[model samples]
Target: MEMERLDRRGLWMAVGAFVLWGVMPLYWHLLKAVPSLQIIAHRIVWSTLLVAGWLFWKYGRGWLRETLAHPRAAWMLALSGGLIAFNWGLYIWAVNAGHVVETSLGYFINPLLNVVLGVVVLKERLNRVQWTSVAIATGGVLWLTANYGSFPWIALSLAASFGAYGLIRKLVGVPPVRGLGVESLYLVLPALALLLWGETHGEGGFVAHGGVAAWGWIAGALLVFGGVLTALPLIGFADAVKRIPYSMVGVLQYIAPTLQLLCGVLVLGEAFDRDRAIGFGFIWLALALYAGDGLLRGRTAASAAAVDT
Candidate 1:
């Protein structure tokens, strides 16, 4: 009973963290004064600082030694970092451009991408229902493309990038915080170079216009918030994974994107055309099938385990 209660707590924590992440566009809206690229640079720079400090505090010199000891892992993590950076930059640009609706659509489509990645990259087999879900989702995307008369490139790109990032992270097999810390370190060099160039070329350097108080502090604050939010959800996810079955956690993963979708349609006032609605409907049906398949498979697996025990 106590264990079950703890699982519930962890689950709720995961949900709350995701909810906070989902509503992030509202916060980004306030930072519209800054250019998107500049904001992204700040995000990388500040998150790097925060993650570096936390790693040093937690692991002392051992963290550095371990990272150095595994060059392959380090390189993999660095590549993963780049992918996430691109994802963040694009997401920031999309939000600032008032495409939150499409952004939400991207995340909604992401889980399906995850399933595809699992099948292709991990050599995992999807059950019939899961396969059907993927097919349905593909149809939805096609419908949307036809409706728009051109591909919804932004949405597709966001989903692809983020899904690829997640796959890379899974393949790397490092602890989430540790992996992210190393990736942030990897990003630091290019970010510094960009900041330098921006300082010389544009008025967008963190604090180039004024010493350090101009808008650097605000950027720094956003970076800190982003890092905290990023880290918290990751920790919550890890915790939930330890406590609950993957089947449950997998289903709950949709909560964040669903909330984002609601916020996009209701709060951001993004329109959903007829074709887009049809597309979303197909996607929703696909998710339902995928989830139903998982539940059934989980039950069968549990029963087999019981019989064996």
Candidate 2:
């Protein structure tokens, strides 16, 4: 009963995290008037300050020193930091530019890309079912490219950048909070510089021009609140992962992109014609196959272990 209750709590936490992520396009949309670079700068700078402040409060002055105790931590976090920054910038651009649907496609494709990364970089092997699923997903991408009248580079780029970030993190294996704190720290200087440059150039989103009051108080508050929006869900996700099975997490991951798709179509009123639907159909089929295969394999292994015991 206790374990079941814990799982319930963890499941809700994961749901909240994914729900927040799924609806984040709306948050970015609220800042559509802001230049993507400026928005990214605010996100990095504010999130760095917020995350670092918490880390210091929780772990004291030497927290950072302990975080970097691993000789390679600094450099590895730098690389991951760069990748995540790129992902964040592009994602905000896509969302605000009315490519929210394509951004949804990117996340839908991300898990499959992770598998390809595993095979290529980690030398991990995929079984026949997994291989078939990947092949079908590839076909889905091809179909979209061939029929959708334009290359979905936004989606592909988002997937690739995030996949590389995950690969880097996996190779180094640092705790999530410590890694994020270091990554944010590494980006703080550049983010601050960008914000400085933007304000001086008369194009910053944070402030109004002389006596103009263009952005207003609400927008400014949302810009600062971007830090909380960015970090809180991630922290919840980390905690949820600690409390649940990875397979459960994997299944729940789809909730994010699915909600993103709904938000794009229903709330944002983006186009979702038959061609895109057909392509998404293929990808969905592939995911169903892959997930079903995983469940079957997991159950079989568990049953065999039970017999042995």
Candidate 3:
């Protein structure tokens, strides 16, 4: 019972972490003056350094050695690294490009995308409610696309990439912080290469005003703070996954996206047109269905498990 209680506490912590993650637009807003690509690059570079330092401090050099020891793990880490970088880049771009609302829309739709991933990749079965939620969510997305006369490809890309990244993380059994450390290491090389290339041929690199103080300070701060900030929620999430079911996490994930959507429409002054309203309404309905399905399934599973015991 004590153990169960501890786990539940940890799960709540995880939920809190996710909530912090949802509030990230507030952070990005601070860096709004910086170019999105520059912000993205700083995120990569700084996060890598921070994670590296922490991993070394916590696990010593041996941890780094072990991460590189297994080729398969290394490959998975590399792929995950690339995917997350793209995700970060796209997210930064979305926020800076006044598409924060749509970015939030992508996250709002992510759980459903995860459901689709589960069905297609994990071969998991969805009951009637789940199926209905999926259908409704699909309808919502389609409606949004129809309204625009073009697909919200950016939104879809973020959702799909992130869903895939989650699936890959599930498949790879590395511990959260250490695994993330390895992923950062994989990204470091490319990031450095680009930084070098940009300095020489692209845009003079790092120094925003011909010295390290201009945008360099901002970039540096972002790099270090970005990784540490990201790591906090991730660690919290890892703790939560151990204590709480994935279904619970899925439910909580909506908090961040919902906030992002609001920030977009309310703060950033993004349009919430009539068509968008209609589509969002349908999406909300889909989320309701999805939440209901998860709850019902969880109760049934608990009952069955009790009976078995």
Candidate 4:
């Protein structure tokens, strides 16, 4: 009963986290007047501050020292940090530039991309179902490209960058919050430099111009709030992973992109015609196959272990 309760709690937590992520396009939309690059810079700066402070409060600085002492981890984190930064900047730009639907497409395909990365980079073998799913997804992408008269580079770039980030984090094996903290720290210098350049050039959002009252203060507050937005969902996700079976979590992950798709079509009024619908149909079929295969394999493996024991 206790375990069941815990699982239920975790499910809710995961749902909340994914829902927050799904609706985040709305938050970024509010900051549309701010340049995407500047928003990313502020995100890095403020998230570093928030996470670092939490670490200090929890562990009293020992974690930071230990993390910094490992040269290999630092290098790996640096690369991951760059990838995440690129992903964030692109996502913010995409959301505000009316590419929310394309952004949704990116996340919808992200899990399959993770499977491909695992095979290529981690030397993992895929079963026949997984292989077929990948092939179908590839065909879907091809169909979208051909129909659209060009590549869906925005979606592809978001998926590839995030997949690479996940691959690196899997190999390195760091705690989620701490890993993100370290990545944020690694990015701080560049982010600070960009903010400084923007301010000096009279283009920074956090400063007032033309006698606008309290503009700088409001912008600064919103920028710091970005850190809270970044960290809260991460905390929920980390908690969820501890209490739920990963297969369930995998299925739940789709909630985010589904919400994003709804936001794009219903809320933001983005175009969604027959061509895109056909392309998405193929991708959805592939995901259903992939997830069904995983569940079957998991149950089979558990049953085999039970018999052996």
The whole-model lDDT of each prediction reads 0.70, 0.79, 0.72, 0.78
- Candidate 4 positional error at 72, Å: 1.7
Q: Considering summed lDDT, which 10 consecutive residues are worst modelled in model 3?
A: 204-213
Give the Cα-based TM-score of candidate 1 against the true structure.
Answer: 0.80
lDDT head-to-head 1 vs 2, winner: 2
Winning candidate number (lDDT): 2
lDDT tens per residue, model 1, 174-250 = 66667777888888888778767766765464553543346566755765576566556655654554555443443
lDDT value for model 4: 0.78
Ranking by TM-score: 2, 3, 4, 1
Clashing residue pairs in all predictions, respectively, total 0, 0, 2, 0
By how many angstroms RMSD does model 4 differ from the true structure?
A: 4.2
Best by TM-score: 2
Model 4 TM-score (2 dp): 0.81
List candidate 4 stretches off by more than 4 Å: 1-18, 209-220, 233-254, 296-309
The reply for model 1, stretches above 4 Å from the true place, is 1-20, 193-220, 234-254, 299-309
Question: Which has the better lDDT: candidate 3, or candidate 4?
Answer: 4
Candidate 3 wrongly placed segments (more than 4 Å): 1-14, 68-71, 193-223, 236-251, 293-309
Q: Tens-digit lDDT track for model 3 on 18-92?
A: 687677877777666555666666666777777788889888999978876765778887888888889888988
Better of 2 and 4 by lDDT: 2
Of 2 and 3, the candidate ahead on TM-score is 2
